[model samples]
Target: MTAPKANAMKKTTKPAGAVRPKLAQEGFFGRSGYFFARALANLRQNVFVSVVTVGTISLALLIAALFLLVYVNLEGLANGWSDKVQITAYFDKEPAPLAVAALKTTVKSIPGTKSVTFISKQEAESRLRARLKGQESLLEGVNADVLPASLEIRLDREHRDNFAVTHYVAALKKVQGIGEVQYGEEWVQRFNTFMNFFRLMGLLLGSFLTIAVLFIVSNTIKLTIYARKEELELLSLVGATRFFIKAPFLIEGVLQGALGALLSLLALAGCYFAFLHNAGSFLGVNPAGAGLSFLSPLHLAVILGGGVLLGFIGSLTSLRRFVNV
Candidate 1:
């Protein structure tokens, strides 16, 4: 070869000895620039696929959040109902005033007793009369003595559940003068059962929903990543590190997860407001009075973090499996 031709060859060719120095001079950004740039370019090229994946993930998260919202509100309502739980003990006959006073003190000594009010036969008769105000004729022949004197037992705020109330009732029955105990046992049991069922449903539904979310969203992510399978394979062939190959995908996953979670939260907020606005018409009670609330701060954080994590995992793990990179 002539001198000019040899010089041209030397300029055109990169020596093995100079490659490391060249890469070192470029530093971190230089070494990863094309991989990062191309990754971004691929994302731009596949906007439709990216959007579909985000939409799928958002819908899944929205559903889970909605369930949580309902569960929280229902739990609040159940707690309110539990708070109203009362146990009433009826006496066979009207006790003497002193006897009633002694009995009230004895009942008050029970562990969970908050307050005990003695209703004399006359007071009980008066209550019945007040209840039947519009039908006074029904009480024409009724006598005050017919109504049994009773102790109206209101339990402590924390111990109003059926079990506590039953235990209190047993303690009351053990009192010498106290008679039969009637505390709407069936109602309390049913309410507790319903509340328990609601909690259980929340657990089961949440589990199933999470599994469903992972399954469906994973498949969507798979398709999105699979669309760039050939590109990823080419990058691998060119000796790109796995980290570099996966960076763009990880970024895409995090973005999708975050955006989807935000949108779902927005949707949930809209639902909450809509429910509150129309609640009075259907339920006849103001939700404001009942103290309905949204998720706590911790819950919100968990959701946001969960979204980002879900996206990251989906990108990192699924990308590898989908493209076999």
Candidate 2:
């Protein structure tokens, strides 16, 4: 009996060194791997729910991306038009090269001025002729000197507002070489009004769309959680912490968002390519000349981030509503 008891003790008393490998294997990374595997299994087992969730996310992101593309392009076009709304200050006389150079420097030194380009009389005439198109023959007897040499001053973004432009015009009139200042006051005011309205509408519309997407994603994710009710209940019964129970769902949400965003991007690229291919006939300009542009990398990143956040929030909201944990 003593010998038998000793053997039993030896069998039960494994060395500390022998137990360490098991502990190490079940550390943070190991647990994370388990959660990851479980999440993937959940996704695979509920194929219909996963597809529906992904599809819903993809559709939402697509709509968002389309609106984003429109907003970006409209903003770009508005900025371009604003840059073209220059202040043309005519020179009283044909100044020497040094005088022209000095005037250019002076114009550039102004606080709101983006750039100053001196347009010689000849270049001005050429521009007029180009504008005239076939009517240029009507000006056969007109002298080039009738046109004025001017400094075209483009304003910086902050200074493109009506009040700023008015102030800049007043300041330019006081400069020594400026014979006359010309800018369309009414036109500037109208442009500013349109820009303000455009921005306001974009903001309201974007907010509505974003909320709609969030709701759709939340509902879709709720379905996914409902499908895994048994698994979640079993985990909870087994003393799994709330964070541990919720983490896999959060990861699933993020995965859905990331994949959805990628799908949207790919779809957008296809549309862009299609647009380029058909742009000439539809828009009267080829892609190169159409002034169409895709979103910048920074903008794309923002879209991806927005999708991820939307997913995370949707998942959190759904879980709170449905799972009780």
Candidate 3:
């Protein structure tokens, strides 16, 4: 009878490790369902407060998104300008066929050279005439040969700075058959300095705006939490874990943030299309000759993530500061 009883016990009982996974899965699903339901109930119970909080978050995120877009485009423009920094090396005489080939090869071999384009006197004169537009007739009697043939040298990005350009210009000036090397030295230096300053200002402004959004959203969430204080207290009284009580509000915050971010994205898309349709020419072309781009895939992800993080932090603040449970 004792041996039979031991065999029956072994048949009825299972190992703890095997049972734990199944139990944990059920617990997680059950907890998630409960939290979702509670969050929906909270929203339904305070429709006005919910709208107000979501609206506030939407506006804040919209403003933040706009600044990010502007900063990104301006930075692109700055880089485009940097890449366009070129030195025009004018020749004393029109280069011979063999000399031109050798000059091209020599310039291409330069350490920092990005590209070298040889412009003939005729091409230079034609460009000048195009620029002169209505005043092109002023060059009616002028000899095309008076305009010197030149080599346009674009430097690599790392060598585009003022110091690097100065050294590059000096080196090019020493090359045979080159009369002068001209790059907008003073202006390029000043522009680079300005770009650095602008980036710094943008960073500071973004930080301040982010903090403002957090404070506003936290206070707004606080109002919602205050309205449901009694319910929260009752849940605590019923032996609900702190995680259980806070889970719903946390979910609510994230949903609100995501919704706000979605709304902002829609608004931005509309504005982007409207702006491009109305003023495509205003934003200059990139090196590829295409018009300016909207936020990249990575940046769009960042904006959404930023919104969710802002909401999570606000909810966490309200729960810790006001709700004991």
Candidate 4:
């Protein structure tokens, strides 16, 4: 009788930890499947609200993306333009060819100067004629000797801002036989100031738009929670864990955000193509010359990631109230 009693006790205890492993396995699989099904059902049930929420997010993301694209291309264009921007230092008269070559070498040695090319008097005259094509007769009397030989100095990118390049050029004012250093100093200064103002405005607008998006998403999620309050309460009263309750809604939010991002990207692509077709000529972006590139795969990934993060954050914020209650 004692041996039988001990055997029965061991039998009962044997299933305790053994059952836990099986239950844990079942729980993981069961919860995952339930979460997926619930998320799909929720999306279908709240189709109208989902659409509105997605559309709003899409629009906001689209505007932000467009600005980002513009900013990237503008930076590229500015860098290209900087390389083209050069100062022409004109000599007093027709210096000897050897002296001009020596001056060119000296100017090229300057820290900011990338390249220096000497434009001879005759070449300068020819360029002037080409520029004033219709008025060639007006310049026929002037001799090549009258046109001064000049050194065209291309500066480094760092020196392209404001009067940095100008100051560097001014240092060569007393160089032998150099008459004057000419560049668009005033125009460059004004352009830099304008770019600064534009960047500041963009920053402010981006910040406001981001806040507005967060507010909209948070409110939408709160509404979703309110509509499903009864179901959540019932689940809580039962044996459903907090993670099990929240998983479905979190998945739904992610789906909404991903769809929104994809739709916005498609819309943006269409708009960009249309703009390129209609206004390519006016914009000076040649169709054949390395035309404008759309968002790369990496950028698309970033957009999708950003969308998912926003959705998760909004859902989490709304879920906090339910958790506390």
Candidate 5:
């Protein structure tokens, strides 16, 4: 046929007046739909790669979240221990009952003092008897006068720190009736040292983990960018706006981050419950009974938001190398 035209073999071209739709010209809803559709399509196009990226992010976040849980519990335990810290001042001679009451009133006015109780020699001896129930006969010669009378001072939360407690003790020494003021100097110093060391370790570990997450996420996104290099370049050549080219990628990253965070939270919940269930025999401890708690609402929000931020940062970092900005 005079040759059936080679139209079937010819490359199709748009009419001279035809042009691609400009997102800026569209309404807000239309623009949003376009972006979501494009992002979803990209995800579908590389389903396996997307899944892997999300899984990696979830695993990384899970490890960090787990450590956070442990650190929070340790902090709570430290606070509880701090509450038990008390200062006991031994008297050279038991103060008069009126003097003891006045001293108690004054100590209560001090910055860190929570409660103060006067322990008479007789009361102190009685306590020892109660404590040494099995060896009561050992106190045969011990009378009420044998045990020293003291004032027991319980400090408020803020004053439990070594420096604060020491300062408070010095203030006590300034009082007229006090002979010796002690708050377990050696033990307080050691407890503070341990707490400081533990906090430093947690900070270092958290920082390193954060860096690892950013680095790995960035490289993963970079790999994705490389896969679509030609398509992006072609769009640029056709005069697609920079925002148009980058919007889908940004959306994709946020999606991955959100999905990863949710998945990690679910995994964390499962692990936490499993541990709690088995703790009775495995660790011989009752977590709930000991005042251990799960993440608070604020903590949960921070972790979820952090995941989204990581994804956005990862995508942005990868895109900067491929796209101009």
Candidate 6:
């Protein structure tokens, strides 16, 4: 009898692991479909609260995403402008052509320097004429001989920081025949300061918004659990496993969060399109030339993942307290 009992125990335990793989291979689509249907039924049962919770989440996510989008674009613009940042070292007088070439080689060899191009006095004069556009008469007395022959230096991205650039400028100014090293000092400094401020603000705002959404979702889920307390008690009395009892609520939470994220994305897209259609030129963002990207595919994936995580957490929190009670 003992041997048979032990054999039967092994038979039961062996199928447990094997059954899990088979069930998993069956895929989640059927389970997900059932969960979605149950979630919709729950939402319909608690229409007012569900709408309020979803609306709150949507508004919060939309605002956060908008700010994030703005921050990303601003950072990209700043990086682009920084890459174009070059130091023009003007010569005190017209140096020999060979000397200019030597100076260009020296500048190119400097640490952090990506490229150095020699700007001849004649080229500089022509550029000035083009810039002035029909005001060439004003530069009639300005001869190429007097115009400075400079070396325009491009720095690598790693050395694009203001302090590094400033130190490089100081060193470059000591080079022979180089009189003044000019760059957008004030503009770069101002941009760095502004970007820092925006980053701090984004952090604070994102934190507060995340907390607010979490609280709202958790409370909503709590109320939902409370409403179905009697049914849950009945399930518990019937010896239903905890997993079975909690599965539906967890699924509902995930559905709520995912739906809210998707709705928010749609609403933001609509707003963006409307703005572009009406005020594309006014906004200074070209409609045709690299139109605004709302979110990258990676960011969209993160949003969906975040929604599912938040939903799961809220459901778990609510169920924990309600089940214990």
Q: How does each model score on lDDT?
A: 0.78, 0.82, 0.81, 0.76, 0.82, 0.75
Which structure among the candidates has the greatest lDDT? 5
Cα lDDT of model 1 by residue, 93-196, tens digit: 77787687788888888898888888888888999999999999999999998888888888876676677777778788988866788888898889878877
Query: TM-score of the candidate numbered 5?
Result: 0.85
Indicate the worst ten consecutive residues by lDDT in candidate 6.
Answer: 19-28
Model 2 segments more than 4 A misplaced: 1-30, 93-97, 120-147, 321-325
Error of 2 at 209 (Å): 1.1
**lDDT by residue for model 3 over 142-243, one digit each (tens)?**
878999999998999888777788888878887889997788888888977887799899999999988887787778778877877887889889987778
Q: Model 5 over residues 130-173: C-alpha lDDT tens digits?
A: 99999988989888987789989998887887889889988898
Q: How accurate locally is residue 225 in candidate 5, as Cα lDDT from 0 to 100? A: 77
Off by over 4 Å in 1: 3-45, 91-126, 134-149, 154-165, 283-285, 289-298, 322-325
Q: List per-candidate RMSD values in Å.
A: 5.0, 5.2, 8.6, 6.2, 4.7, 8.6
- What is the per-residue lDDT of model 4 for residues 1-325, given as tens digits with 9 covering 90 to 100? 6999989988777654555444534454666877888889988998887887788778877877787666655555555555657788988887787687788777877778888888999999899989999988899779888888888888887777776776787777768889888887776777678667766877887788778777876787778777778878888888777787788888888888888788888887888787844444677666334335576788878888877877777777777777543
Poorest lDDT segment (10 consecutive residues) of candidate 3: 283-292
- Which residue pairs show backbone clashes in model 5? none
lDDT of 4 at 313: 79
A best-first ranking of the candidates according to their TM-score comes to 5, 2, 4, 6, 3, 1
lDDT of 3 at 105: 86
TM-score of each: 0.73, 0.81, 0.74, 0.75, 0.85, 0.75
